[model samples]
Target: MFARIFADRFVLLLLATILLASFIPVRGHAAEVASLISSAAIFLLFFLNGVRLPRHEVVSGVRNWQLQGAIFLFVFGVMSAAGLAMSHILDNILPPILALGLLFTGILPSTVQSAAAYCALARGNVAASVVAAALVNLVGVVLSPLLFALLAHVGEATVSGQAVGRIAIILLLPFALGQMAQRWCKPWVDAHKDLATWMDRISIAIAVYVAFSGAVVAGIWSIVRGDELAWLALAV
Candidate 1:
């Protein structure tokens, strides 16, 4: 069982990435390049997701209002409340910014591709996962900034028109284009589902690497104590 779990390439790659980032965090121009690559990989990941997702499934998924509503409530309401409670509990132990970051995470959307992929693997409702993830993100585009401003007392300028434009360009536009070409692309996509799965994993790995690299460069290890990380692990 241990070997089976470790044999999952994504898990191994993610662990390797965290270790690498701790030892040799990307900085300056290298970090910039990694950021760009991560962004491009995200676009490709979403595009492929669109190509693979059946239109009928999307339609049905959208119509599952009950499931979507539950997911939204969990993400925006319960999670946010929990984050606030945790932040207060950990404020004395954790850096203020780190506590705030934890709170901020609760207000974010459900992860899209990863959630859908996992749901499919678990023989659950993958279509609902896809729609719910997308809906949560769309709502979060507006709601997250407001929540941050209210709960964290932070400035609300983060979710501007420019941010929306970037989201549209990087996420929605590619998905839409892929959907438009789905009729012609479906066969190839179906035949090579593993390719799509690996692409998604690689994109996620790239994102994790870039994120951890930035954290390492910013002296995260120095700021966060081992006990704090242990607490974080339990909380997560």
Candidate 2:
């Protein structure tokens, strides 16, 4: 039973590692090492994603512009409407910065992994779901800032060309590179699928750790109240 549980939930273990890392107090030089480790882990995740992305699959889906457009429009419309409505309701209650964070969260597109998992569980089209989610995120990399600027009057602070470029560099470039590598690595990826599997598990763990550790080091965790954390957790 224990073995099966671990087999099914390896990602959670990585998350635990990250959380533990975040709590480990470090002095001057040690803190720098910790920060470096966290940054390395985050980059490793993106690198792994790039290495694992299936080029043929992504290329084939590129022709399905109609489906991609539908997904992009749906995500943009729903998130935009939801953000506006939530902002109106919570404008007086939540602090502006927190509120902006919440809005930013909603502005983000649906995560590809979760959306694909849900589609599989529902016996829906997993391929379509994966492609759709990917397209939404890709488009959101640009459209999000534009919508924020237009609807929220979010100036240079909330949405900027630089932000779009940075996001594209960090996220989209990895995905594109992964796709390009997929063809060359197809046979090996098939023969040793465990490599991709491990990369996925490790990447998620690193991400959670880096996020929590960064927050802890910056003292942002202390400023936020327990109730606010609870709310954000629930909101997500």
Candidate 3:
């Protein structure tokens, strides 16, 4: 059972990335470079997705009201509620930012590339997944902060232009550009399906590495106690 579970090459690579982040966490200017590289990988990831999926499929997926409605409620209502509950329960044990991070994560939408890649791998509707991911994230841009303000009561909620711009550049813009270039690019992507799959995994791993490297550099291990870390992991 253990061997079967560990058979996934992606999981092994993910573990390796986490281990690398723990030991050799990037810092200062180097960390910024890593972040930029990860962002580029993500941009490429979504762009490839846009190229591969058909426009007609995207349109039809968006019009699937029942499925989209269910996802909307689950992501916004259910996930947000769960995050809030976890935040309250773990409040005593965790640092404020860490506890709040749970809610922040919950309120956020699924990543376009990662979600669509998983759906495709599972032989599911990649078009629907892509549309769903994009739709929810677009809603999340407004809803996430509103939920935080309402539940956390953290004064007036403010979103920075830089944050929104980053999301647009990394997530939305590349996908849009790819859609425009899809006429020419789609054929190539279709031919190199395996390479595209690897791109998905590589981008995801780089993202994980950059994320954990930032945490490690910030002294998360030193600040968060062992028991607290365990509980945090469990809560997550």
Candidate 4:
């Protein structure tokens, strides 16, 4: 019963933890270490994800490009537009910092595990969900920063080509390695699939905590409001 309750409220727990962490301060070096650990954890989760997926399903869905592409575009476009609209509106009624909070919320890509789990619950295609969610993150790494530069009037310094290239390396190389590793150890990962699931969930929780902690370090909590969070939830 406890497990079932946690499963149902994982996203809520993540959001709550992120909010709480945003208000707590950490030392500078500890912050950097936490960020590094969080990034590694998320990458490992993604890689293990690559391993645990049925290879045949991923390969077979290569032919279903339309479904994947549609979902990807829809999620990206909708989220971006909603972010811009909300931020602009909030900027008028709220303070600058709170408006900025809305911007960051929109900048993040669609989450993979949540999307996949929700799709399965809704009796939709899990493979399609995985592909679409991954594609969102993969493309968002470039498109998101570019959008900020173009639409939000952010400085080129923040969206530098060098930075983007580094981010691409950080995000892609791990998945590539995981794919290769999974192919080599397919039988073993298949034999112990349950461990991969636990790792994925734990990594997500860690990522949430780390993100909120960074926001706290940056002093975002002081600006955000209950009303804005409610609107963001509805928009999402």
Candidate 5:
């Protein structure tokens, strides 16, 4: 059982990526190139998502307002409150930035690809999961910054027209184009759904690598001690 669990490709790949990032993170010009590649991969990932996701499913999913509302409230309200409480409780134990990072994570949206993947695995409503995840992110773009400003008393310089434009270009534009092309490409996409799944996994792995590389570049490992990491792991 342990071997079976450990042999899972996704689990192994994730650990490998983390280890790789820790040992040899991309830096300088290479980091910039990696970031661009990661962005393109993400764009392609969402584009394929648009092509594959059935319009009828999205329509039905959107109609389920109650479910969407519940997800939003849980993510933004309950989870954020819980994170704030935990930060306070661990204020003395955790670094101030780490505690703030925890709070920031709580206020974030539900991840689209992972949520939909889990829903599919559980034989749940994948369409609803996709819709809920998208809605959470759309709302989060506005709410997260405001929440940070109020709760953390941070200047909230991150949210701006440029940020919104980047979101539109990287995420919305490709998805929209894919949707427009879906009628012609749907058959091919459906026949090769496994390919799309692999692409999604690759994109996610790339994102993880980029994130960890950034943290490494910022000296996160050096600043965070072993015991502190243990506490963070337990808290997570």
Candidate 6:
């Protein structure tokens, strides 16, 4: 029981972090510093992720193009279209930022590590799921933002050139650098996989906390009422 709960610590951490942000959201100069720290945490998280993945596996994952292509079409294509349609449907009902979030979530990549595990649980093709997830995510790092730009409305939200640059510089560039260093770093990474996993969890929690801190201060509660949030959850 304890092991299971410990294994689910990331989820618990996220819930706790959200509550903390709701009660005591970072403000003013502290908010700015938190943002910078989150950025750096994100940079390190992606860098570690880059270092961790085996390049050979990634290349192999790429060679399985049919599965990758299908997933790509679904994740970056069909889902984006669905999100765009739904965002429009809820235009009068939901807040603009919340509606935009619908599109953003649609464009976001699949959780690579979880895909294979889920597939295994369902007694599906775990190998195919693993490779397809990896390849799709690798491409998605670039494709998601571009797709969002294409699908979203004029003012609801915008993925500016700067946002793209940040994604590239802060997210993709580090991952690429990690891949380049993978040959030398792989052994160390393998030995300390548990440490890396903890780092990943902590970094993600920090990012979420910082983001919600801003949202909390920006009147996220005032803008999104309780009923609307319930409806949004159901719609999703």
lDDT of each: 0.81, 0.62, 0.86, 0.66, 0.81, 0.73
Candidate 4 per-residue lDDT over residues 27-72, each given as its tens digit: 4898788778867776776666566566667666656888777766
Which lDDT tens digits does candidate 5 get at residues 1-236? 88987977877888999999999999899999998998898788778777887888868989998999899899999999977887777778999988888888778875665676556545688667867887787777888889877888777536667766777787768777877889998899999988777776787788789889999999988899998998888776
TM-score of 2: 0.68
- Against the true structure, candidate 6 reaches a TM-score of 0.71
User: TM-score, each model?
Assistant: 0.88, 0.68, 0.90, 0.72, 0.90, 0.71
> What is candidate 3's local distance difference test score?
0.86
Q: Please report, as a residue range, the 10-residue window in candidate 5 with the lowest summed lDDT.
A: 113-122
lDDT (Cα, tens digit) per residue for candidate 1, span 115-193: 7656755667766786788778877889988997899886654667776777678777877787888989878989998
Model 2 clash tally? 1
Better model by TM-score: candidate 1 vs candidate 6: 1
The C-alpha stretches of model 6 lying farther than 4 A from their native spots are 1-7, 88-101, 107-159
lDDT of 2 at 86: 73
Tens digits of per-residue lDDT for model 6, 199-235: 6667667777888999899898898889898879876
Candidate 2 Cα lDDT to native: 0.62
Against the true structure, candidate 4 reaches a TM-score of 0.72
Model 1 scores a C-alpha lDDT of 0.81
Candidate number with the higher lDDT (4 or 5): 5
The superposed Cα distance between candidate 2 and the true structure at residue 195, in angstroms, equals 1.5
lDDT of 4: 0.66
Q: CA shift at 127, candidate 5, in angstroms?
A: 3.0
RMSD of every prediction: 2.4, 5.2, 2.0, 4.3, 2.3, 5.1
Q: Report, for all candidates in order, the number of backbone clashes.
A: 0, 1, 0, 0, 0, 0
